[model samples]
Target: MVLKESLLELLKIKAIANITIKELCERADINRSTFYSHYSDQYELLTSIEDEVLDELQNTLQLYNHSDKNETFEMLQRIFEYMASKKDICQMLLSDYGGRNFQNRVMSITHQYIIQKWEDEQNILKSHSEYVTLFVLSGSIEVVKSWLSNGMEDSPEAMARWINDFTSNGLSCIPKNENSRLK
Candidate 1:
């Protein structure tokens, strides 16, 4: 716990990639040996931060029931807000440590969000559910990544509306033939 606090302090000072164990130890008031005892390197330290963040996020997300599709919007906004809270860490994670793995993790989270909701609702459990899940997950991530990349110009509330609108329109576009069951 102390080490993590020191690491976060160093992260506030500079980029994660540039933070050496020696500096972390100094900031943390621990010896080099203690730093080594805790983590392998800076990458490991960042990974630990990621793990902690994910744990918190999961807990926060679990609080919301799955049946509410609107929670999807709220969740993403919450995540963005979390990132926004840690501006320096966000800069480092999004710029350096984060990449395809990050994107996959995000898509997986989005999928879980919807699947849980779908199960609770018991409304769309077909095998083709994967299609819809992937569609929403990927598209939503793309929108988020774009928002982050664009300096988060739009507030999260606005972004959620953008997503809700885009998704609702796509749902409306299913043709009459595909809607045969509805009739």
Candidate 2:
């Protein structure tokens, strides 16, 4: 636990590729042998942390039937709530220092579930589903990153609603003046 937390702290400032085992051990107040005994290297420790968060996220997604729109929103709310609960780590892991690997892994996990839901519930054409899924997931990830970066002033429910609304209605979900030129 100490080592993991220490690594997370280091990740906030530097990428895992740049973090050394000695620095990590010093951060955790442990010796190099102690860290080596549990993990092979910094990457292994980082992977361990990512795996833990991913496991919990996968379990959270499995708790609801996402095929239904309403259920999907609820599931998203729960996911945001989970992210809120782990704000520190989530923020760091999603930051530039966290690397594309973790983000790609997250996308992979959600992509499977979301694409399945879209195919089953909306009957989106198979040819277009991948593009649609990638667009939605990429935007959703940026939204979550923004929410976290902004200190998450909005409630998870509210964030979830915004995401769901955008996903379902696109730009139409935003209101505009009657005289607005763009229609």
Candidate 3:
């Protein structure tokens, strides 16, 4: 916990690329031995923090069982609320100072979530499901990145509704079987 707290504080003042193990240990009031006992290096420590964030996001998502539109929107709201609660971490990860790896990891996780949701919906796609999923995921992530970069000024519920509207509306354009219900 100290290491994570220290790293986040340091990230506020310096980019991840600029932070060093010695500096992190000092800020954390711990010795190098203690630092290395937990992590091989600074990058690994940062990655652990990212993993923690991802785990929390996943936990928030696991609360939902159904794939209905209302449930999906509720899930999105919880995700945004979680992110808003951890704005410091989210902001740091999304910032230009934050390495691309963190952002990519976030996007990858989100894409996986969307893919799972789409699968649950059992909707038909004109193209490969992977392509359609990627299209929706990537576009949604861009909108979220912009929201984060802009300080997440909008309420999480408001942002979630907007994202839900955008994604569901776009997905409606995909051709489907006449017998299938729109997800």
Instruction: Name the best candidate (by TM-score).
Output: 2
- Taking all chains together, each candidate's TM-score versus the true structure is 0.65, 0.94, 0.79
Q: Please list the residue runs of candidate 1 whose C-alpha ends up more than 4 Å from where it truly belongs after superposition.
A: 1-31, 96-99, 119-122, 171-183
- Distance (Å) between predicted and true CA of 78, model 2? 0.6
Clashes of 2: 0
Query: Model 1, poorest ten-residue lDDT window?
Result: 92-101
Ranking of all predicted structures according to lDDT, beginning with the best and ending with the worst: 2, 3, 1
lDDT of each: 0.67, 0.90, 0.79
- 27-136 per-residue lDDT for model 1 (tens digits): 78888987888789977876886676667667767877545557766765676677667654455454433434445665676578667667557677656677877887
Off by over 4 Å in 3: 65-67, 116-120, 171-183
Model 2, span 93-130: residue lDDT tens? 89999888789999999998888877887898877989
- Models, CA RMSD each: 7.4, 1.5, 7.2
Pairs that collide, model 2? none
lDDT, candidate 2, residue 169?
89
Off by more than 4 A, model 2 = 177-183
TM-score of 1: 0.65
Lowest summed-lDDT stretch of 10 residues in model 3? 120-129
